[model samples]
Target: MSASVRAVIFDVGETLLDDSTFWGSWADWLGVPRHTLAVLVGVVTTQGRDNAEALRLIKPGFDLVAERAARERAGHGESITDADLYPDARPTLGALRDAGFWVGIAGNQTERAGLLLRALELPVDAIATSDEWNVAKPDSRFFERLCTWSGHRADQIVYVGDHRDNDIIAAHSAGLHTAHIRRGPWGYQNADDPKLRATATWRINELTELPALLISSDTG
Candidate 1:
């Protein structure tokens, strides 16, 4: 870890947010069993395909945007609730801010998700989404926007997330430090891959470990 790091940005889904309800809600909308959708999500993940592919597998040529709109009209829209957060999420983020790090949340989530997160009033300096910025992760432009929003240079920021490709690899490639949190599906799966493990500056088991990692890195 670099002493130059001054900010910590987190991914939303599966990092701070549990996301089980997110998927289950989709299953309910599609009239499929939650377990069936869950299994399909796992299959897509193992294949390194987009998780949205699971929805497409259920209904070919699925227009995600249209479907989301239709769901809203039908009063079955995506929702975010307090229970969707990992228990450690708020405390860790608050701890980091208390320790004097500029903290933010940015992820490949929709504008609605962004608004919902802001509504929760998370102790963050900023909260942004791909939909809000019109760019998504693994896209260099997205990281550029993150750096800009963070008010710090890329190298001076440490991004934390669960995905190897979208979070660690992509953030590292953008010249930012990365912490891989091993909690969610992608987290558990990537933790087993030695090469992917090597890509992150640090690996942690939970969000609570982050403040200590940053503090020790500063002191060490």
Candidate 2:
């Protein structure tokens, strides 16, 4: 572990969970073909567009609550579970905790997401969400709340995620070490952006690489 780092916080979505299937489910509920939705999502992501903008382009005035209710009525939204988590997530978190680092999750997610993650029983000391904090990432308050929750100095914390702006750049600006994990549409898109890439303290392909990087930092 890095001697300077006392805590490691992570973003949700593509950081710990693979949400492609979840989005596909949403597409199905919206009566759009999966392939069509995939192409549209990919196009927008590649163009560095936000999810809300992409959704508006696909279906104007998209109501998440209504769509979710409709999907539930049709028996679709119940498919996603802890099974969506990446294979490396559990082991990496466990290793970090066992190595004596305070591990937590702080991300732009709904309140239900925190409960869902708790059900997964991941080895985390703390978990928080935008819904609970009432502030989303890229905002200074979000990072401040995360630091408060982790009980660590900003410089002694590491924030890891797949999003460039929401995770790496934002966390870096708040004085935390940042790791960019290349996966998912956002990760792939931002991976090619030199400005985003430059903000990352570490760029890794998988979560399993984190423990070793922390160890190396200790020695370095």
Cα-based TM-score, every candidate: 0.96, 0.91
Residues 144-216, candidate 1: write the lDDT tens digits: 9998888899989998999999999999899988999998789999896776677798899989988888877
Model 2 Cα lDDT, one tens digit per residue, 1-220: 6879888899988989898776777677667888888888888777777775656667798876676677668766535376898999999999999988999988887776777778888899988889888999899889988888899989999999999888999999999999999998888877868977788989999999998898769622
Q: What lDDT score belongs to each candidate, Candidate 1 first?
A: 0.91, 0.84
Query: Candidate 2 has which clashing residue pairs, if any?
Result: none
How does candidate 1 score on lDDT? Answer: 0.91
Which candidate number has the best TM-score?
A: 1
Looking at candidate 2, the ten consecutive residues that score lowest on lDDT are 71-80
RMSD of each: 1.5, 2.1
